[model samples]
Target: MSIEYGEAQLLPGEKIAITTDTATEPFWKKAKERKLTACRCASCGHFRMPPTPYCPECQSREMSWPDLPGTATVFSFAICTRSPYSGEPLIYVPVVVDLDGAPGARLVSNLIGIKAEDVEIGMKVTVDWNPIQDDWLLPIFRPV
Candidate 1:
């Protein structure tokens, strides 16, 4: 079965590569296991999204991948009505979620399981994994 994002259907063979980097490999690896992981700096103890080899805050070269609760609040969002790829009118809510317990970390993901018009700032949400491929997983969000 293919993954469905509202009116858009993502087939098996249509899956794209999530990432190909040594530094960010752990993030994708944990996602495949249905777990959310973020890099926490060993120096200043700050969480960094789009995981990097060095900490942006403290410039620390040491980092660790910590398991996240996957619970968040919608800091901001936008309802996209036009498909950038196909140019067909579609509906999708893209949200920036402020990770719970991770003060400085925010993840950009899509909101599902609800209508676009229903999404609002500060709405509680939880992560939902879409297993598009055997090794790749997409982290979507749904209202909690």
Candidate 2:
């Protein structure tokens, strides 16, 4: 899905991570960099999306961020032709990407630079990083 925003291609806002100390600051910070990071329990070693201070599995408060594989498929998507941003036609494809290392783990991100008709279900795709910040890289998917 290609979105032509006419000189407004870069994303806005600072990204930060979510933690007990600061709920949602760093979360957007990490996203601004184009990298998807998940919190892992130190005890049970269970991965958690939308990073949390405590582990939902073992109920442990100890967690750490880990780099996950960005490869995934078009589990589901939608073609968005209308947008509130300048009223420009944007093809938005929301994809659920399953990581290579973390089985059953998935994340949602927009797919760009591809045609809406060319997108297919179960199509092989890879992740690309967007360097909006120096500390992180947000993962974006594209066709293989």
Model 1, span 27-97: residue lDDT tens: 88888888887888988999988778889889998878788898999999877776656777777777899
Model 2, runs deviating above 4 Å: 1-36, 131-137
Clashes per prediction?
A: 0, 16
Q: What C-alpha lDDT do the candidate models reach, one value each?
A: 0.78, 0.60
Please provide, for model 2 over 39-80, each residue's C-alpha lDDT reduced to its tens digit, 9 standing for 90 to 100. 667788887665667777888987665665556777776666
Off by more than 4 A, model 1: 1-15
Model 1 residue 75 lDDT?
96
Give each model a TM-score.
0.84, 0.67
> Model 1 TM-score?
0.84
- On a 0 to 100 scale, what is the lDDT of residue 61 in model 2? 80
- Model 1's lDDT to the true fold? 0.78
